[model samples]
Target: MQRFVHGFLLLPRCSLLALGGALDALDAANATLGHAQHSSLCLSLDGRPVRCSTGTKVQVDHGLADAPELQSLFILADLPLPDAARDGHARQLHPWLQERARYGMLLGGIGSGAAVLAQAGLLDGHRATLAWAQVPQLGDSHPAVLWSSRVYEIDRQRLSCGAGTASLDLLIAWLGRLHGERLAQALVGHFGLDRLRGADERQPSPVQARIGTGGAKLAEAVALMEANLGEPLPTEEIARLAGVSRRQLERLFKQHLDALPSRYYAELRLMRARRLLQQTGQSILQIGLACGFASGSHFSSAYRSRFGHTPREARSQRALAWRDEPDQPPSADSGRTESPP
Candidate 1:
């Protein structure tokens, strides 16, 4: 059997959780097979220590220019993506990544790394995903990449996922394609995973899940409300479309969400406005109108009532909260494992 090699390109403030999960999955697979069928190394833009999202420092085995023999390379990119063309570090990586892709090395991105790959023109015209709405700006033009909101995406040689634990699932799916289903099943059993998520599965939404569990009436009503948030439908019309009376719809919302139907609907719109405020560069009025509020004053009062802060304050605090989380220690492994650097 041929020994396969893999690599992870660690960017500054990369998610240690994503990296650790990917590494642990591979290590578990090797252990389950009772032999070392694969190996992995870490790479950085420079041959220096890189800081992970959790502030843990990792020592890479090599820099981009000195990559090792590898079957695949996975990138770990930051969200609110740093401008690759202008950022000095990203500029150093752009050409190096393009060179690797030209040779058909099965380039993949973990989480927002897909955005970084797109910036390098590596994922253009391909189905890729990042959990963010941010796109890389390339020479006043955006990449022609088909973005998906799925938990993971595997299009031919380009693999990507929302990362977190999803990276383990992506690896298993790719490995099953590479090796065999038998080994893949064994890996799953070794890890005791309840079920493997498919690549096409959409990322779960807490708001949607409120109605997604049970009760068809609640589901249809919430779905209609979500779809028509811009110009919200009347409670009566929503109830009629949901195959329930107005009173029945109100009761369902109360039972499931502990809020009246109108209150729940208003909260949903407000929550969406909150996300837009944090994620986009839109003006407060624009976001308010998009989420169905009629005027700036109305939106501000409702938002303050719900979140206890003004939209401007929320925008200023929009940096990713997980960036400051502490890195976790490596999981114990039966096979050879790399210690947290």
Candidate 2:
């Protein structure tokens, strides 16, 4: 008789979408493997309800302050967490993570949850993966932790994935370990996944796999642009980095992306600026400077043009969403069960 037991600690602003998706997959897996009896629970700080990134409410079953013993625990976090959320819940959950790691219990950090784990001193000297979008900040913040952009990775006891659907991959890998590949596959089938990702497999990033029309060079160029969102490059410089002439770069974007390189770059920069504006407490000027705008006026003009609203408007909406949303549940560690060809 084999049994699988796992628990997840939800952080403030955790991705409820991913959490719910993984939970749905887990339910299907349990049904397929006849393991509805599997042990699982969702925990939070003081066992309170949590709000997802998108303002959904989820009920949790326990609190780290209440439950101290679990075979495994996953941390679910979304980046740019309010200091209140991180310090209030995630920091409170840190001591428990340390205790679990010391005992060699499997620890999982989904998306930027790795940040919380790092704060706990659990991810020190361990290679980990985080949402690629947060890579820049994560690197600057957690210099002690080795970070990668892979879909999911497990270095010894620490496990993590980027964001979004890759969580399913993490859950699948956990099931595989507990019940063997047979049950893992059963779970994958239940979720309509065709295969499982190896530890080395990368979940596709938009910058890497150009869906509509770009080649490697263009993709690489896009990646560079994304990585340097806070400090955009000149069009000629981007062309140089991509090993294409300025004219050639313009032609490529026109032909494939259907947008000029300069316009696309500005859009990407503005998009990031908007995220910072909404997700962080940074001032509008700070956001503008960080996103490569020369001045607040420039950022405001570009933002209004592209989004049809001021940056302040977006921030206000996000704040409203955050304040109005309900609580959320926890997360689990499952890997991509389907192999990527």
User: lDDT at 116 for candidate 1?
Assistant: 75
Task: Give the top-scoring candidate (lDDT).
Answer: 1
> What tens-digit string does per-residue lDDT give for candidate 2 at 1-341?
65546787787788876676567666767777765745778887656798888887779997666664577778888876535342445444555567667778888888688877877788888988888877655654567898877788878888888667888888888668866888788877777777877778755666455544447678767777876787788889998998999998888778678999989999888877766676557788978887888998888899999999988888888889978987554333111121111
TM-score of each prediction: 0.69, 0.68
Number of the top TM-score candidate: 1
RMSD of 2: 8.4
Assess candidate 1 and give its TM-score to the true structure: 0.69
Where in model 2 is the C-alpha error above 4 Å? 1-4, 24-37, 82-90, 206-216, 224-246, 255-341
**Which ten contiguous residues of candidate 2 have the minimum total lDDT?**
332-341
